[model samples]
Target chain A: MYEGVVQDLIDELGRFPGVGPKSAQRIAFHLLNSDPADINRLREVLGKVAEGVTFCEVCGTVAEQQRCRICRDERRDATLVCVVEEPKDVLAVERTGEFKGRYHVLGGALDPLSGIGPDQLRMRELLARIGTDEITEVILATDPNTEGEATATYLVRMLRDFPGLTVTRLASGLPMGGDLEFADELTLGRALSGRRAL
Target chain B: MYEGVVQDLIDELGRFPGVGPKSAQRIAFHLLNSDPADINRLREVLGKVAEGVTFCEVCGTVAEQQRCRICRDERRDATLVCVVEEPKDVLAVERTGEFKGRYHVLGGALDPLSGIGPDQLRMRELLARIGTDEITEVILATDPNTEGEATATYLVRMLRDFPGLTVTRLASGLPMGGDLEFADELTLGRALSGRRAL
Candidate 1:
């Protein structure tokens, strides 16, 4: 039962992924009471991103230029490419500070039930990128989910015939934080099945 | 580390009141992937509000013109004014559909420690509004918290001598939803002290 514009604002804020009605109301009113200058700054940035940002032509990560910094930097290891489902996945892997390689975003995972197939992805572009002599190994670093696994499997089948190309799926096991007793049977089985010679 | 613009967008999203690092990252990336049309709409509305919305000159609620809709409506009971601390409080009281009267927004609660005093509030404007011929009663409906109580007490004292003005404070009691056993001692004491003979 709020005023029209206020209700509109609350409804819009609630459409965001995790923001519920109560939170949306709180945020909307907070914005209503806040100084216009601060709110304008946020609006400006959002507008700029929508207008200026685009997916990297080389890797599909968000960028203002043709290629993302990771793809453009000459110092990055061109021999190693980490394949992932979405641009956000690229950030998740980068946060660990362990991988110093380039990335190739697949736009989305393969979900056959939803009618998504290999042709919908940037498979041809990835194949062309790999055709260059600089790349030696491709790391399948997609999420450890069913769709991600299916996408990785599809990529493996498509790229297997390329001579001298070594394809490897990232390892899955008990999480660093996990309790063995609480682990599900399938996960425990996978942990056992994928055991390494320690 | 991400490309500079992605990092900038993440930082900007994080500036919202309750959003944390992971949430900010997710929203930033969602915006990155979302249809540019939707992002443009949000930006347009935000810009519109920033440029056009203003405080009602009469009651201090958010408005697009000189007065808020409630105040501008001739049918509303101008004789009774429900005084509240913030614009959001006005919306909450309105949602009940119980108050037939209009509202007087105090901008914020009284907090001497925070350097907010009676002089900083809209008390003078409230007095001016009440002194007019049509007004009959003033209802103090500030929140039950310490700051709200202080503000209500200040209003009561200030309006004690107004001729023909019926000054009344909203009753303090156990909320309709609240468990009596879970209520704090002070609130329980108030509930017991204010008990009516049924």
Candidate 2:
């Protein structure tokens, strides 16, 4: 423990995801030793972010206004919607520079064990958007885990009733530049089953 | 790569020690998704810590008032002073519950390459404290690296001029439960050199 305010700062920092107690102490001390101007800047930015940032009305991604940047961009393919679990996933997909479609963040994947269901997510908004927007394809880009698979399967079954809508899942196989020997059984099996001829 | 305020939050989080860009984005998004009440609490705590916390005038440790808790406690041994590089080090030593003395934080170890000399440290305060107080023993508890060793050597040389003052360094040896086979050469050598008769 430390002085009252120092301990309070460490406890607050420890609440952040992935920061352990040791890391919290280190960061708290670092901030304490840093320049007053720098600390003020960080504080200003944190307060500004809390007040200025909000969820996009259309797609649930983080935004400064009613709509996120991707949703506001008319150059992106409106007919194709990439459904992801979180806003962070939107950034992950964007890093490839391959997907040029709009995104719908589901807030989180379905984990019945954790009490997360379709109604708990933004599934209702997603369905409404799909029906109103002239979307032809919906790509499920959730994580490759049990919760993600369950969410995708549920979506696929529900979207089946849509007359012209097509649904697809991102391919799961060996990663680029990865060795075959080190690949896991499920990934190696998927790669074998989805093999292509040279 | 993100909306205005979101990107600003990420950039600010990335400035923290050991937090990379990816971690910054993750934390920013996590904060965005968290309840506004929680975010406000964190912000309040940060502001409170920055405004209220001040360095102890007696020992240079973190405090909310003029002196630190340890320095204010009359029951502690005023005649023994443990010199460390940072306030965090004081916590580490206190956790051991072995030292019942006061502390003197040097701010940082002597690293000439980093332009940190004796003048840059709280060395003047330490010398003044020793001269004024009835301190009989000074323990050099700096880290066991080049900078720490350099600082200890420098302090020992400087303190030699004082009469009837005992100077000591913390014992250097293999850590508890550490395996001999895995021990580095330098550590093993120190363990051998500092071997006890028990």
Best by DockQ: 2
Per-residue alpha-carbon lDDT of candidate 1 for residues B76-152, written as tens digits (9 for 90 to 100): 89899999998888888988889989899998889999999888999889988887747889999999999999899
Across A27-72, the per-residue lDDT of candidate 1 in tens digits comes to: 8877776788978888878877787676799998887678888888
Candidate 1: share of reference interface contacts reproduced: 0.41
Clashing pairs in 2: none
Q: What are the Cα lDDT values of the candidates?
A: 0.84, 0.91
DockQ of each: 0.49, 0.62
Candidate 2 per-residue lDDT, tens place, A1-198, comes to: 888788888998998888999988988888876777777777777787667577899999988789988899999999999999998899899999999999999999999889999999999999999989999999999999899999999999999899999999999999999999999999999899988889
Residue B63 of model 2: what lDDT? 86
> Lowest summed lDDT over 10 consecutive residues: which window, candidate 1 chain A?
A1-10
Model 1 clashing residue pairs (backbone)? none
Candidate 1 wrongly placed segments (more than 4 Å): A113-115
Interface RMSD values for all candidates: 2.3, 1.9
